[model samples]
Target: MKISLKTIIAGGALAAIAALAIAAPAADNWENHCAKCHGADGKGQTKAGKKLNVKDYTDAKVQSEFSDADIVKATTSGISDKAGKEKMKAYKDELSEAEIKEMAGYIRKFKK
Candidate 1:
């Protein structure tokens, strides 16, 4: 069997494209699930965000305080204040574990 150089290059290119397609994170979930409260820029400036005191994802100081796992946990399990007031709702029902992790990564991109 003989494989031509063009065939090898095309195969390599296709492999690279496939890898990128699989590695690329899905962000539409973030926009649909979080943008309402987190804001498109993740500034937590929306009306409900203000009411709930949503964390400002764009703040470097705030970003450094929480690890990615913490974000994932909070997103999956939801959050409440010291007074037991609901700060955020649990997404475990609507999002898969992988999706929650990806959303954490999306949140990280807001660090500034």
Candidate 2:
């Protein structure tokens, strides 16, 4: 059996496309989904962030408060206030499990 060069190149291209479809870069995802509230610097200083009283990711004390699992759960299930009003929308529908995990790691990088 012989595989043509064209077939090999096509296969590689398809694999790359599939990988991209599976997981986007964490920074891009953050900017698209979380930055409006979390801020690009992760300080939670945006207008929305201020209104919602979002935590400052740059705070070392804040970073120490949550585990990676906590991050994943909050992201997967979303957050609500004590009154049951939704604060953050769930991303489980938009992101894969792997992507969610990556987001947790990305959030950790915000610690200052």
Candidate 3:
């Protein structure tokens, strides 16, 4: 097979685009899952959200206080414990650090 230079460049570009496309949805899902409890507006006011006393995601005071590393830790370890209440589970095992970082970015969008 004679692999042309143009074909190689095109393939590399295609691969990069495909990776981004796949990653975008995973990040979106992470955002949505966080939103369900945190509220679409990140206000923690959904009918099914109050049980957890969900964090006020849009609070500028709260958001500004945390560093990106802190936010990623929150997602991996979670802000709540799963003791008395069935809070959201730790995602450290389910998601990679990079993926969680993306979720952290998504979380920032909710901040006021």
Candidate 4:
């Protein structure tokens, strides 16, 4: 059985497309999880954000204060108020290790 040149070209194109799809990273987890408090723009201006007094991730100074490790820890373990009560819910149970690590990088993009 002989394959036509067009068939070979179409197959190659489909393979390339499939490869690109697999290589591309999924949408940031922050949108689904953090955005409610952080805001889609990362300004931390939502009502919950205001109530919790969530820090604006878009602020460069705030971004500089936390290392990537800090971000990862907070994400996995959750944050607390001055009284040591948990304010944020821990994602350690919900997300994978790799996803939590990726979230650290995702949050950094909020910095101006």
User: How does candidate 4 fare on TM-score?
Assistant: 0.73
Please rank every candidate by lDDT, starting with the best: 2, 1, 4, 3
CA lDDT, candidate 2, residue 99: 89
Worst 10 residues of 1 by lDDT: 19-28
lDDT of 3 at 45: 85
Each candidate's clash count: 0, 0, 0, 0
Per-residue CA lDDT of candidate 2, range 54-88, in tens?
99998999999999999999999999989999999
lDDT per residue (tens digit) for residues 1-112 in model 4: 6999999999999999996544333244677778888888888899998988889988999999999999899989998889999899898877777788888788888888
In candidate 2, residue 8 scores what lDDT?
97
Better of 1 and 3 by lDDT: 1
RMSD per prediction, one decimal?
5.6, 2.3, 3.9, 4.7
Q: Which model, 2 or 3, shows the larger lDDT?
A: 2
lDDT of 3 by residue, 37-105 (tens): 777677888776797787787888978888989878877886655465436767777676778888777
| TM-score-superior candidate, 3 or 4 | 4
Q: Clashing residue pairs, candidate 2?
A: none
Off by over 4 Å in 1: 1-25
- In terms of lDDT, model 4 sits at 0.83
- Number of the top-ranking candidate, with TM-score as the measure: 2
The digit string of per-residue lDDT tens for model 1 on 16-100 reads 9997654445477777788899888999899988887788998999999999999899989999889998888999888878878
